[model samples]
Target: MAQCASCYFVFCLYCRMVYHGVQPCRLRPGEQRAIRDEYLSATPAAKQAMEKRYGRRTLQLLVDESLTQDWMQENSKKCPHCAISIEKQDGCNKMTCWRCGTYFCWICLVALKASGNPYQHFSDPRSSCFNKLFEGAEELAEDDHEFRRVLVRALPHLSHRSRPRLCLA
Candidate 1:
């Protein structure tokens, strides 16, 4: 909370809007996005200022949440049956949900649990993902060389007991 010395108007310091005690600010959605963007692009000194204003943990949590949401959107899709998020590492479109064991098409997101032959959906001429069972595999394969080079470069120092965990962050 803050008060304008001249106008004597009261407002929330975070949102810069009229104070509403104990209730969340009305400017949250857009305001929060703007703040997040600003914080991400800010310099170390400016980031410290933001951390001082918003608290270090709060700002870190916001940034972590934003990054996680973006990575999930880019790399994962939800199961149509159980709605659980599934990441397709490398394979055909046929995906089995780890949680519910529901078979599904990774490309079309249609449940394949009812079908006797799930691969038939890919072979059918009328299907959207027809002849696309190996869809996106070519791109992944192209990157395999670079990925292998990185792994090979790191292999010299890596030991079975001392290998570091992989982290995308």
Candidate 2:
């Protein structure tokens, strides 16, 4: 939430609408990405102008969050119960959320706590992920391998930077 000094109108920074108490903003799609891209490519003068409009610290935080969110969306899945990003380093499709400890199916993002045997979902005829428990396992393993390689290569240079080097490969 932020306030305009001239108008005294308080609003969400992401949605640019009147502030709502404790509710998530319904921000326009690609809005954050647009801002981040512009900021990243902006000239020093343009960046200064942006910082003047949006505080330097706020803008930096927004850019960082946008970058992190982008990376997370690509590399991880949100826990069904807690919504915390969870990456599968090496495992089966069944996952337990670290934060909430809710058992879930990684492929379908369905909470499996209600099911006595979580793995049964994969064999259940009516389930979406039925017969596909280890779907895309090979592809994901290759991608994770590439990501680890990229991260190892980027680690030295990343120490000097404020943001982690994204492994887009």
| Every model's TM-score | 0.67, 0.64
The 0-to-1 C-alpha lDDT of every candidate, in the order given, reads 0.76, 0.77
Number of the top-ranking candidate, with lDDT as the measure: 2
Task: Indicate the residue-level lDDT of 48 in model 1.
Answer: 90
Error of 1 at 153 (Å): 14
| Top TM-score model | 1
Off by over 4 Å in 2: 1-32, 51-58, 152-169
Q: Identify the runs in model 1 with alpha carbons over 4 angstroms from their true place.
A: 2-11, 16-30, 141-169
Clashing pairs in 2: none
Per-residue lDDT for 53-75 in model 2, tens only? 55676577677567657778888
Model 1: clashing residue pairs?
A: none
What TM-score does model 2 achieve against the real structure?
0.64
* TM-score result, candidate 1: 0.67
